[model samples]
Target: MTYLNTRGSRVSIRMSKESDLTVLVIGSGGREHSLVKICLNSPIVSKVIAAPGNGGIATEAECHPVQVDDPADIVSLAQRVEASLVIVGPEVPLAAGAVDALEAVGILAYGPGKAAAQLEASKAFCKDFFARHGIPTAAYGTFSDVDSALAYLDTQSYPLVIKASGLAAGKGVIIAENREEAASTVQEMLSGAAFGDSGRQVVIEEFLEGEEASIHIMVSGEDYLMLPPSQDHKRIGEGDTGLNTGGMGAYAPASIITPELEQEIRDTVIRTTIDGLMKDKLDYRGTLYIGLMLTDAGPKVLEFNVRFGDPETQVILPLVADDLVDIFLKCARGDALPDKLNLHPAYSMVVVLVASGYPGSYPKGDPISLPDQLMRSATLVHAGTKINPEGELVTNGGRVLGVIGTGPTLKISAEKAYALVDQVIFSTKVFRKDIGWRQLERKPHKA
Candidate 1:
C-alpha cells in the first residue's frame, strides 16, 4: 500500500514498511507513550504517530490531531499514512471495533475484535467466558434488576467484588469489605445512575483472598505467547488505602509465580482462553491482559483487557529487548513467534503520579516540571496531559506520568522510580509508598 509521501517522493511500501515501519498508536495515556518510545527505538521503525496523544507523547512521536475515541479518524489516519500497524492502547477503541474497522480497509490493527473485546467491555461477559471456557475463576452471578441483586447478596460472603457490567474505565469495580458495604455497592450499581449505562447491570462475586498479578499474552489467532508477569497497585493511597483509581503503580517480575506455577497458569488460564477464541472463530490479535488472583485454591481470573495494561505496560515494555514493531507486524499477519522473545530479566517498577483530589476531581493546568536531560534517566510516560494553546503542559487526566525504572532488583527499581518522581513536580501529586510490599515475604500463595 503506497501512498504519496509528504514530499511526493516514491517510497515502496508493503501495507506498512517493516523497516522504518510507520506505525499509528491510538490512545492518550502513559501506556501509549511508552509504546511510542519502544517503537521509535526499533531499528526497523522509521516513524511513530499517535492520535490525540498527551504532552509526553508529543516529545517522542509526531502527534496527530484525532480524537482517540473516534475510530473513523484513527482508521483514516492509518489509511492516509499507509501505516503498517495500528496499536490500540485503551479499551474504548477496542470496544468501538476499531480493529475490525482498520482491517476492513486493508490496514492491520493490533487489537482484539469486538467479540473478543467483550471480555473487557462487560464484566458479566468475562464471567460468562470463564464459565464457558472452563477457566477457573471466582464464582459470581449477574443481575440487571435491583431487587434480584439485593436478594442474591443475602447468601454471599463479605469482602465481595462488585463490578459494573459495562465499561467503567477501571473505576467501575468496587471491593466492599462487609455485607453492608457489599449491599450498598449492589444498590449503587443497579441504581443505574451511578455509572451511567455502565451500571445498567452488575456482577457480584465471592472475594478470593490472594496476591494479584497482571499477565499479558500476545495472541495470533489460536497461538498464545505470554509476556513477563507484572503487578499493578490499583488503590489511591499508601498501603493501598483509599478509593481505587485507574492504577497507582506497578512492578514486573513479581515472585508470585514460580517457574512451575507459570507453566500451570499457561496451561490453565492462558491456553484455555486461546482455545476458546479459536473454537468460537474469533480472531484475536495484539495483547490480552489477564488479571489473576493467585488464591489458595488456585489462580483465578479477575479481568481481561484487549490491550496492554497501563502502569503494567510502563514496566513490561522497558524490559523487552526485541524490536516491538517487527513483533507486532508478525502478529498481525498470523506468523508464529520466534522460539524466544528476549526480555531483560530485571526488576521494572512504575509509579503513577496523580493530581490532588484525583479519582474525584482535581486541579488542572499545573505546569509539571520535567527533570533536566542529565537527571532524567528515568522514563516519564505521559498519561493524562495536554498542551495549552499558550504552549504550557498541563494535566488532562486523573493519572499523569508513569514513572518507570529498571534495575538489578525490585528494591533498586523502586528506589530509582521514586527518585525520578521526586525530581518532577506537580501540585498535590499523590503516589503509593508501598509499591512492592505485597511480595516482600517471597512466599507464594498456599495453593
Candidate 2:
C-alpha cells in the first residue's frame, strides 16, 4: 500500500492491509479500554483482545489473564492468540522489552524497544538525550548521593523541581517551593523511603513556570503524526492543590495551545525529536507522549512517556474517527502516516473517579452501583474494576473509572461528564468537580 507524498515525490512501501486480523492490546487500564474501543471501530479488526483487562474492556474484547510485565508471557499470549498486530498500552511493558520480544518472534507490535524506552524509564538519560540533541528543555542536574545533591542545591535558588530518575508510577515528581523543602525531599527520595529503587538516582531541575499540555505523536523512524493537543490535571485536589496522582481529569483539544503554538511545537519539538532519534539510529516506534510546558519564550519539553497517557488517552481517542487499528499497524510497520489525521468536530472531557485516599493507600472490593434511570451519551470507561463471585462490580484500583462526555462546546461537555459521574456510586467515591476548568474560562476557538 502507498500514497503520494504531500511534501515531495511519491514513496513506495511494503504494507499489509489484512481485513481479517486479530489485534492484541496489552494493559488493564482505561487507556487500554480506549484502545480497544477505537480498534473495534475499525472495519479490518475482526477481533480485539485485551490481556488482564478491566471489567468494561471485558465487555468489548476477549479478556485474558497474564502477567503484563514479563516479556515472555506477553509473547506467548500473542502467539497463542495469533495476533497480527499488538498495541501496548503501558510503559512498564515497553521498558521490559515487550515489543522487542514480539518482533523477534515475527509478530508486529506498536511500541518503542527497551533502548529507546530509556527516555521514560530513566529521567537522567532523558535529560542527557535532550542536551545531546539541543532540544529546548529545562536545565537540570542528576545526583545519586545526598551529599552531592545537597552540595549542588546550595548554589541554586528557591522553587526547584525534584524527580526520581526511574519510573514511580507518576508520583516521583515533587515541586519544592523553598530550600528547606528541597533538602528534605531530596533526602527522602535518596534514602529509599519514598519511591524505593526508582528514587535511587534523582534529577533536580529549575522549576518551569507555564501551563502544561499533553501531546501524542505516532512515530515511524523519521515520519510522524500528531494527535490533537490535550491537558490533564495531575494534582489530586481541585484548583491544582495537593499531591499529584497519575491524573484526575483531562480534555482535548486544549484551548491554551493556539494554532501558531501548535505549529511551532510540531516544528521545534516533535519534528526535531523524531529526526534526532533517527540520526542516533535508535529503532523507536509507537506513541511518543510529549509533555510540554508552553513558556513565554517558547515550548519546552517537560518529560517523555513511551506510551499513551492515562486520562489523556481517555479523552483524546473519543475525538478520533480514523481506524486506530490501521494507524497502529502502519506505525508498527514503519510506514508513512496519512497527511491529515481525522478527528470529530467537537469537544471531549474525561473525569476520573477514584477511591478515597488515592495516590496513596485506598480500600478496594467496594460494591459499585450505576443509576439505571439516567440516559446520557457519556461513556464510562473503566480502569480498576472487577467482577465479584456474586457477579457484582467492585472497585479494584486507585483510579476506578473515567467518565467521558462530548459535545459542541467545552461547558456542555464538562457538564455532561460531571452528570454521568454523579450517577455512579461506590463505598468511598472521589472526583474533581472542575474538569476542563481552564478551557471553560477561555474564549471559544476552533479545536
Candidate 3:
C-alpha cells in the first residue's frame, strides 16, 4: 500500500520484512515493553526499537540509549533509525511535544501533541475542560495558594480528594479522610513541599465512590477504537488498604462493566470528550485513557492519561487480536479506524511485583533469578530492571516486573499469573496475592 506525499512524492507503506518499516518505541518501562512485544507479534512490522530499554526488553528489540525528556534526542534517534512509526509511550515526552517534533520531521508519530496533552499534564486544565464541556467528572476547585485552598476545604465535606495540578508520576493525588488531613495535604501541595513545582497549584475535588475502570482508546480526528475495559488495583496493600502505588495489578475484560455500562460510558464520557476536543480544535490524536469511576449515577471521569497505563497495558495488549503495528500505522497516518476493536473472549491479568518498601524508598541492585520457561499461559514483562556488570538481570527501580497470564477464565488467568510470580526470585520481591478478587466474586460470563 502507498500514498502520495504532500509534495507529490510516492510513499510506500511498510508492511513486512520486505519493507523498511522500522518502528521506534519511546520509553523504558513495562508499558513500552508491552508495546514492543505487540509490535513484534505483528506480521507487518519489520523491526522494532526501544529507546533506553530495560534488560528484559533488550532481548526482544534493539535497545538504544536515548533520553526520553529531550525531544531533540528522541527525534534525532528516530530519524537516525529511519523509524516509520514512532510510538510515544510515556507522558513526559508527549507533554514536551515529542510527537510534534517527530511530525515536524515528517515521521508518523502516535500520541497527542503538546497542546492536546494538557488533558493529562495539567489537572486544573482537565477539570476546567470537563466543566466547559459538561462532561461528567467530580466537581473541582482549583487553587494556587495555601490560604484559598484551606478556605475551600473548610466548606467541603470529609473524604475529599486533592490533586497536584501538574504531573507527579501518578503520586500527586491524595484522598483525605477528614478535614485535618485535607488541610495539611492542601498546604503540602500548595507550598511545593510534597511534589516540588508540580504541586504549586492543586485541584480539590469531590470524593467519588464506586468501581474504577480504565478505558483505552485510539482516536484520529474523531475516528476511534475502544479497547476492552480493565480495572487496576492502585493501592499497595491487599483489600485496598495501603498508600497508592503506580498500580499493583490489573485485569482486562472487566466483567463488572456490563454491556449496558460500557455503552453508557461510550455515550456519556467517551463521546462527549472527543466531541469536546474537536470543538476546542485540539486536533487530538493517539491514545486517550479515560480513568472512569462507575458510580451509581453513571460513569464519571476520575482522571485522564495521554498514554497507555502500565500494568493495564500488560493485560490489555494480550486481548487484542488485530495486528498492533498495522493499527498504529493507520492511526498515525490519519486513516479511518475500525468501528470496533477485535477482542478475544478471554480474561487477561497482570500482577506487578515490586521491591520491598516501594512507592517510597526501596533497595535496588539486587540479583534477580528467573526460570528458563514460565507456565504455558504466562509471560514475564520487565519494568525497572537492568543488566548488571556481571550480565545478570538486577532490580533497578521500585516496580520490578509484571507477570501476565491469559486463559479461558479469570480464575485460571489469575492462577497462571500468580504461578509465574512465584518463579521470579529477588531478595525483596513483593506482590499482591489477590489480583482479580472483585472479578472472581462476580459470576463468570455465560457463553
Model 3 bad stretches (over 4 Å): 1-19, 443-447
What is the per-residue lDDT of model 3 for residues 234-327, given as tens digits with 9 covering 90 to 100? 9899987788999999998888888889888888988888899989988777898999998888899988999899989999989998877777
Per residue, candidate 1 scores C-alpha lDDT tens digits across 1-447 of: 544322232323454334757788888888889889988898887778888788988877788787667778888888877787788889998898887778767676777877888989988988998899999999999999978888888888788889899998787888888878888878877887779889989999988888889798887776666788988888888787878888999888777777888989988998888888877777677799999999988899988888898889888888888877777776676666676668886888888999888889988888887877624336788898888888878888788788887787887788888899888787768777788777654555321
Better of 2 and 3 by lDDT: 3
Cα-based TM-score, every candidate: 0.92, 0.93, 0.95
Best candidate (score: lDDT): 3
> For model 2, where is the 10-residue window of minimal lDDT?
6-15
Where does candidate 2 clash, by residue pair? none
Q: What is the C-alpha lDDT of each candidate?
A: 0.81, 0.87, 0.88
Error of 2 at 349 (Å): 0.2
- How far off is residue 246 in model 1, in Å? 1.2
- Alpha-carbon shift of residue 216 in model 1 (angstroms): 0.7
C-alpha displacement of 1 in model 1, angstroms? Answer: 5.9
